[model samples]
Target: MSNIIGIGGSIHDFASCLLIDKQMNAIEDERITRVRHAINSSNPCQPSLQYCLNWAGLQLEDIDTIIANDDLLQVIDPHVYPDIVLVNHHLTHAYSTFFTSPFEEAAILVLDGAGSKLSGTNGDIRETTTYAYGNKNDVTVINRVFGDLKGKNYVTKSETLMSNSIGEFYRAIAENLELGWLVGPGKVMGLSSYGASFGDDRFISEMMSCIKLLPEGQFKININGEKGLIDKFFQIRQNYHKKEDPFRIDAAIAHAGQVVLEKVLFHTLDYLSTKIQTKNLCLAGGVALNSLVNGKIPFLTKFKNVHVFFAPGDSGTAIGASIWGYLNNSNQTDDLIRFHSGPFLGRPYSSDEIVTALNSIGLTYTQPVDLYHQVAHLLSRGRTVAWYQGSSEFGPRALGNRSILADPRNSLMRDHINSNIKHREWFRPLAPAVLDSTTAVYFDAHCLSHWMQFVWHVRKKFHKILPSITHVDGGARVQSVSKDENPSFYTLLENFQQITGIPILLNTSFNIKGEPIVETPYEAIHAFLESQIDVLVLGEFLVVKKFDLTFKSPI
Candidate 1:
C-alpha cells in the first residue's frame, strides 16, 4: 500500500493531491479561499492536506513519499517538515495527461504561460523530455528521454521545444486585448466568435506579420512595446461599433486566424508522428484547455486518438508531481494503468454537518429521499438551484457535484444568471450537463466529456432549444454525465428528463464571479443570499431564501 502526496505551488493555483497505490484518493486547490490566483500561500495546502488525509482514512505519517510540484526544497523556507521528493513540472504535466487518457498511445502536448527554466552554463533554454513506462493492461509506455530543444541537437531538438509553446502568443494577444491581466486568453477565445472574415489573403498576411514581429522563443516584448499591435488588431472592433448594425466581423476574423495557428500546431504534430508512429496523442498545460483546438484534433492531426487530462492547467501539476515522485522513489517499472475518475477528491460532508449548518442559519428545510424529483420541480418552476454534493472536484470546473442548476428552457435565464446570479461578463456562455447517453442526440461531438473540458457544436435543431448554454458560435462546453461517472448527478438528469422531456440542464460553477466554487454549505448560503440564486440544496436539505416582496424579474 504505497501512499504518495503531491504538492504544487508556482505562480498561481497552489494545489495538492494524494494517490494511494496509483489510485487518486484526494485533490484540492488554494483558489477555494476566494483569493484570485493564490499561489504558494500557507492557507491553501495545510488544511487541504489534512482534509485529504482524513478522507483517505489515513494520517500524514501514513504517507510513504511526498512529491513537491515546484522545487520546494529550494524555494520554501527551512523548517517545513515534509522534505518532499522533487518532480519536474513538464514531466508531471505529461504524465497527468498520458496516465489519464483512454488511449494506449498518443502524441502529448504541454503548453503553459511559462515553465521553470533550468540554467545551463551556456544559456537559458527550453527543454523537451519524454518518459515511457512499460505496458500494463491499463497503462502503456512508449519512451522516456529528456533533451534540450536548443544547443547540440539544435534543429531536430528545436522542434520538440517549439511544438510545446504557442501559448505565449495567445497570452500576449490576451494582454493586448485589455482583457484581465492574468490568464485572460480564454476571454480572447470567447471574443473570437464575434470576428468576421477580412478575406483570406489579408487575414493571413496580418497574422503572419504579427507572428514575425513576436520575439523569438521566450523573449516577450513588454506590454508597452506591443500597444501598436493591439491597436491594429482591434481596429475592426472600433469600426464595427460605429456602424448602424454592429456585427462581430473582427471577432470572426480573429477566430479564423486562431484556427489557422492551431493548424500549425497540427502540422508540427504530424511531423512528430512520423517518428513516434503512435495513434494516441496526450496534451497538457493551459493551452490544452482550448476546446476548439482539442476538438479539431481528430480531424486535423495524423494521430487517430487524442487525450487531454481534465485539469491541464498549472493546478494539475500537483498530481503530476506526485506521480513522478512515486514512480521514481519506488524504483519500480511504471506499471500503473488506471486512474480513478473521481476528481471529487476534496473534503466530504456528513449529513450531521449539513444539519448543523442549516440549524445554525435558522433555515427551514426538509430532507427528501426523492432529491431528483424535488430539485427538478424547483428548477422547472424557474428557480436557480445551488447543488452541492459529495467531495469537491479537483480541476477548475465544478462538474455536477458542485454546480449551479437552472432550467435551460428560459432564454432570459442566461442573462439573469450572468448579470444577477453569477455576475460574470455577459459574453461568457454557460455549460450544459446532459445525460451521457443523449449527448449524440444534441451535440456534434462523439466523445463523452465527463469533465466538461470539451466544446461541441450544438446541433442546429437544438440551438434555439438550448440557447442559454449555447455560445454565439453555436458551440457549448458540455459535460456528459453518466451513471458510472456520477450516480447522483446522473439520477438527477434522469428525473429531470422524465419531467421536462429534456435530458439536459444548464450547469455552471456554483459561485459568483470573482469567487471560487463554494466549498461549504455556509458559503453556498452566503452566495445564494448575495446573488439572484433562488434555491440552495446541500445534500438532502433544500433551502429557499426569502427575497424582498417587491423584487421581480421575467426569469
Candidate 2:
C-alpha cells in the first residue's frame, strides 16, 4: 500500500533503495560509474531514485516517504527531495543486519569508517540495546537505547557525546598506506594475515602513542589528512626498521593492533550484556565486512547470537535510511522485512541489448537452452569467460550475477585470471564459487562462507587440484552458492561439475584492472574483447573472443 525510497550519499558509496510495503524491490549505486565511490553532486539521488521507482513499477510522486541516511541531507540537493526521515549511520547499519538475520535476537556490532555520532568521547564505541518487532501488529519497537559498560550494572546514557571511533582507526591506517583511504583497507586486511602479531609490549606502546585511553574512553589523534595515513605508518615502520613487503612484520603488527581494538570492543560489549541482561546483538557498517573479526565474536562475547548485515558497508545505509523514514514519519513500528539474497537488485539487460553487443563485437556464439552446459564446455577447455546476467550486484564482490568465471581445476588459472582479466595484485587471492552441496567436501564447515566473506583451510585432497583458487596458506575464500539464491550460477556450477568433476570455479569481478565491476553488457563486452578472456556470456547469448594464445605477460 506504500512505497518508500531511501538514499545515502556524501559518504564513500552513493546508494539508493526502494522498499515496497517494507519489501526490498531494488538497490543500486553510482559506483557503476567507475568513479570509485562517487558522491552525488547534482540531484544525487536522481539516478537511483528513478531506477528504483521504475523497478517497483512506481514513480517519485507515488513514493509515500523518503529516508536519508546519516547527515546526507545537509549535503544533498534540497530541491529534488521526498518527505524525509533521518537516521544515524550506525543505527541504520544495525537495522539492516538485525532485520535480515535469521535470529530473533542477536548481538550486533556495527563498525564503519564513520557514521553520525551515538555518544562518548570517541563515537566509535557506543554500546546500545535494541529490540526489534517481528510481527506487524507488535507495537513495542525501539530501534536502540544507548547503554554503558562501566562496572557491573550497565546504565543507560541519555546524554553523552563522544567521537573516538574504530572506523577512523582503519581509515587512518588505509590513508597511511598511500593506498587511497576508502579503497585500500581490504588490502591492509589481506596484508595483515601475512604478518606476525605485535604481542604485549610492542602493541601496548604503539596504542599509547597513537591513541589516548582516557577515563571515560579512548581518543585517536587526528592523523588522517591529505598526505595520507599510510605514509605516516611507513615513517613509523622506518623507525622500527621494517622491510619493504607490505605484508612484513610491521604490517602484521598493525593487523595485530586491529585485533586489540576488536578485543577492547568485545570486552566493553561483554560487560554491557551482563548489565542489560540481553542475549542478542546486531551489527552493521563497513567494518562488519571483516569476516575474521566477525568470526571471533562467537568465541569472545557472552551474547548468544551475532548478526551482520549482508551489505554492512555504506551501500546498505540507503536501505536503512528509507526504513527509518517510514518508521519515523508513519510513527508506526512494523515487522522487520527480510532482504532477498544476492545483491542483484539493479538494472537488468534485454535480449535486444545482448544481441546488439554480440553482433557489434564480431564474435560467434550459440544461444543454447542449456546455457550452463555450453559455458561449462568453455571452462572445461581452460577458457575464461565473463558472465554478466540479470541485474548487477550491489556490493564490492561479483556474486555470480556479475562475475568472471574460469576453471578452478587448473592450478595456473589464478595467475591467468589475475594477470589477463582482473590485473590485480599478484599476492591477492581469487575466490572459488562452489556448489553449496559440495562445500563440506572441499572446505571446513567452519569455512562455509556464503558471501566470499571468510578465509578457510582448503581440504588437502583438493588443494593441488584447485591450486589457482587456493591460497599459499592452504586457505581459500569460498562463496557457497545455492540454487535458490542464484539459480543460473548454481546450474553453471552443476554443469561444470558434471564435465570436470569439480564444483568450484575461479570467480573474480567482471572488470579489468582499476575498474569498477561491470555494470552493463557494454562494459562487460568491452572488457572481454580487450582482455584475454575467451568468452563473454551476456544473458542468453554467449560471445567467444577468438585470439591467438601468443601474448606477452603484463604483470
> Any runs in candidate 1 off by more than 4 Å, and if so which?
39-44, 54-61, 70-75, 78-81, 121-164, 196-204, 212-257, 330-336, 546-555
Candidate lDDT (C-alpha), each: 0.67, 0.65
User: 1-555 in candidate 1: lDDT tens per residue?
Assistant: 788888765556667788887767555555355665564466545555676787788988888887765434334543453666666676678767776776655566665645555555332344333323313322333332222332122212211222234565565456545565344777767767655222323344554454322212222211112322344445644565587243354355456556655754655565556656677777787777787677777766676576778888877888877766666666555555546565776777888998888888888888778878988877776778899998788877888888999888778888888889877667777889999999989998857777876788999998887878888878888888989878988998888888889999999988877777888878877787788788888887878777554543343
Give the per-residue lDDT digits (tens) of candidate 2, residues 109-227: 56555555454545344433233433232223333333221221112211122224455566555545544567666766655555433232344345435444332222343233222
User: Each prediction's TM-score against the native?
Assistant: 0.84, 0.82
Q: Model 1, residue 160: what's the lDDT?
A: 20
Instruction: Give the poorly placed runs of model 2, Cα more than 4 Å off.
Output: 39-42, 117-163, 196-232, 239-250, 272-281, 303-305, 326-337, 547-555
Quote model 1's TM-score. Answer: 0.84
Best by lDDT: 1
lDDT of 2 at 521: 76
Residue 301's C-alpha lDDT in candidate 2?
Answer: 68
lDDT of 2: 0.65
